[model samples]
Target chain A: MEKPVSTSPLGQTLAVSGVSHSYAGAQAVDDVNFVVPAGSIAAILGPSGCGKSTMLRIVCGLLRPGVGKVMIGDRDVTDVPARERKVGMVFQNYALFPHMTVAENIAYGLSGLPREERRERVAQMMSIVRLEPFANRLPRQMSGGQQQRVAVARALAPRPALLLLDEPFAALDRSLRADLQFEFVQLQRSLGITAIIVTHDQEEAQSVAEQLIVMNKGRVEQSGPPAELYDKPANLFVNGFVGHASLLKATVARADDGNGLLRLASGSQLAMPGPVGFVPTSDVVLAVRPEHVKLAASPTPGALLAKRVLSVPLGHLMVHDLLVEGATPVRAIADRASESAELPRDVFVSFALDRCRLFPAP
Target chain B: MNRNGLPFLLPMLALSLAGFVLPLALLGVFSFVDTSGSPTLANYQRLFADPFVLSVLVDTIALGFKVVALTTLIALPITLLYWHASPALRRVIVFLTLLPMLTSNVVRTFAWIVILGRQGPISQALVELGLAPAPRSLLFNETALVVVLAQIELPLLVLPVMAVIARSDGALSAAAQTLGAGPWRILVTVLLPMMAPGFLAGWVLVFAGATTSYVTQSVIGGARLIYLPQFVYREVGVLFQWPSAAAVAFVLLAATSLIMLAMTAAARHPRLAGHA
Candidate 1:
């Protein structure tokens, strides 16, 4: 098939407002709302069964939301059928047509195009995906990576306004996933199309998407730039899910200064800017990233007394599992370059107050 | 199979040789031999020359074709329903489809007779609805025979298609939907092509079953419409024409084989089957 004799496709903005869906009386997506600006990529990141994929399907018009409107560009397309949505989706398994050759599969969506243009489009897509050598080969004959590329090429061949990928790298080898992910992001950027990717892998989502929407239990837990969500999570779930963190049980303490105070279970007091509405003596879960919890052999001011249980070397850093106050398990990382010599069992764990996040206890 | 698998296969091989292959081989030889125990083409020449026998042969092939077409038409929707049905509903459909096959074909043909008889519900309904002047015997006609045979062979067609659909990746159709294809386009471009293997298998079964169905043909077809199976039975049982009966039977077999060969060839075509 040849490419169409027209200008490159322009991306369309997607706005999902108060979308909710259920299957067999069980809620799958609950009041989900987000917007992907035109020509930008957004990622719906969540764990398995978090309704991210369901939300993507609703946007693609595969499954209609039980309530709310889906706006693509300036049109309210909630009532539109999947075939008329002009959305291309790459399924988890790729779902390449087994009976069709690579070229045929890529050309399937271009049925409305002229023969010469469709062929040209197919040839262009094949070159983009680097599958020109296997043009006549069937899907089963290609390797997993090649099959994935074919799926991408097929979805892109029609020059759809938006592209949706559901766990596109879930089936690829772990070693090959990064390369494909990079390639897909490049392809999507070069095309300048609105794209949504649903994945359970946080790293993959953060790496590829400009806007990240994290979902949990059928609702969006948090949505923002990945760095913002990582640096200052909106809630405990987002803080714990977006990146690795150690949660410590603590209680809000009254401080002489305007700053808030936290009393850890280890009987150590640390002062920081606290949530305004939190009352003193209220229970809260304090979260801190491993890098922020610095380990020191000697006791430091406001540092929790801890005993190092184990240390695992990770290339340039050493991850130490420390038992703070002999009960709370806290993970801390020490620089391998500076802390080359083995340390004693007892150490003090200090928190970078600004980097720590505190949340209300459930 | 390996050496060990041969021993496991011996019992089934022995049963097929004794029950099926031996009888077929004997029938092939008998079609060539005359009553005087001499190898001759007299039987073939006489049967081929008989207009009634030739008509019966042609009618049998036509009947097979009709049954295949009707059964396919009937099974397609049922298969689609089964594909979209819930697990519990699918189980119920499976049970109902296989229920008819559990009873003997003779019993089913008798049941069809009762339904299509002059005093049956269909005749009574036709008279009551003012569609007919009186209760007429609709039992013994080509239409009734074809309808009954299609009903009998419906399960054979549905089961294979359902099995193929079950083994297929349902996401393929969803993929097609996402590719901007409407339901009708998806059916013609994606689904029907993928179902070729199952369709071919089911077609062969239904065609073979319809053509060789002696009990259904003799009971429902009666004396007016004489299919090849009924004709074979008449030549041997009523006239004691053993050589002519065997020749006619061979002709039936050859006709069925020829059609099946063409169908198989068509199904295996690269355009239809997508074999690169």
Candidate 2:
């Protein structure tokens, strides 16, 4: 992951404030607010139907917010119609004009330019996307990834100040999706265009975005860098959402030294770093990532013992689900390179202190 | 099953062949036959050489083109209005337009005759208002024929053109507008081009119907009209000149076919072909 630069010259800022919208009386976006700095990618990350797409539409001027304003670099363009807003959007399905060849589709948005300039820019965009050879081939004739490239080229050809992509890579297969994700990041960097991508895929959002806005039920739950979000989630929703974490109910034993000893439901004591404003004897839930849980044959000091219930291999890692007596299954991801095949049936698991998060139990 | 189906279908096919193909073949044969009871090119020669026949041919051709052009120009805006109209309003407009098509052609033409004729409602109003000294007959003129034909064929034109516009992917128009094409430019550059097939189909139908019209012209123009179909009817049915009537029929068929061929060729252009 690259460090986010504090500032950049190509910055084109977009601010969406208190924007609320609905469809047929059902609210899709409720008082959503965010700022996407210029030349940076801000991702609206959420599960499906979380109103992320609605927010994108409102920002692009496709849909007007029932309340509040959308500002692009100091211009309040909330009421502006989609065409005149000068915001380019890429649809999830690419939405390429099927009848037009690749070059023609890329040239569509630049049609108002002088004929010579339009042709030159189209040629330039075709080369930018490396689609010069297939310029005359219709969209239906191209592969999915190629068509997606053409779509991106078409949207970028006009040099829109703000680009909005709605689940742009949702339709591609996994391998192709990763390739396009890197390509899009590189393109955004090169062009220095501000963008907001709406996606439900957490891995995609974490990998491509500079800032992540996690949303749920038309409200922003958390917002920060992907690693920060994964490491210190604001609430249970963010903890479970950003990455795989098992929630274990525990009672805090003491509050001294900024740490508390928690007794799990299975009658095991585990050390927990107290969250800000938390006190001793308070009930709390511990969030521990599966990869941070270490598995051992014999019971290690400060480790909880459990019986091995199942081992599921996920290509490069193995997830062991253990039945800790009188408690929920404990999940641990073991790297395939370090794990031994002849592991004992009963094992003990301990959490790495740095990877655990504490939140008020609810 | 095949044997049984063929038995039932063969007679209808034969009937159609006799009713349609045989007459066309006879017309083609007679078009080259002269009046001296021998195979000659005299009829065709007369068709090309005689000023009167040539003038009538020109008039007929001009009427076909004029009717088609007028119908298309009138139908396009009306169809676009229909495309954008609310569902209820669209239904009402469609129903009203279809009323003329439902009525008999002769009745519609006579209705026009009554309105445009001397002492009819139009002339009565005109005369009553002292717009003119006396009632002037509007019957028996090319203008009256055109008005009647256009009214009669309008629904035919509207239905097909509307279907085309309705089926066209509206995204193209939106795409055009987003690309900086204004409403009128979008209509001309995108919508109209996409709707060309429907317009072509409608124009062909209207042209063919108007060119072959005998009832409307005869009823509207009375005895003075000399459109090709009326001329053919007079020659064969009234004067008993079957050969000349067949020659005239062949000429009309050739003209209509040539128009269709030209339209088909124009439709093949890359800009227009993409619409399909």
Best model number under lDDT = 1
Q: Which 10-residue window of candidate 2 chain B scores lowest in summed lDDT?
A: B169-178
What local distance difference test score does each model get? 0.87, 0.80
**Model 2 Cα lDDT, one tens digit per residue, B24-52:** 78778876666666897776666678787
What are the candidates' individual DockQ scores? Answer: 0.43, 0.21
Could you say which candidate leads in TM-score? 1
Q: Write the per-residue lDDT of candidate 1 for residues B35-68, one digit (tens) a residue.
A: 8889999899998788988888889999999999
What would the per-residue lDDT of candidate 1 be over residues A1-362, giving only the tens digit for each residue? 53442343568999999999999999999998999999898999988999988898898888989998999888898999888777889998888877789999999988888798888989999999999999998887889999999999998888777899999998999989999999998988888989999988889989899999999999999898999999989998888888888989988887455788888777877778644257888999989899999887888787778888999999999999989899988888878998856788998878887778888987
Report residue A146 deviation for candidate 2 (angstroms): 4.1
How large is the interface RMSD of each prediction? Answer: 2.6, 3.3
> Per-candidate RMSD vs. true structure?
3.4, 7.3
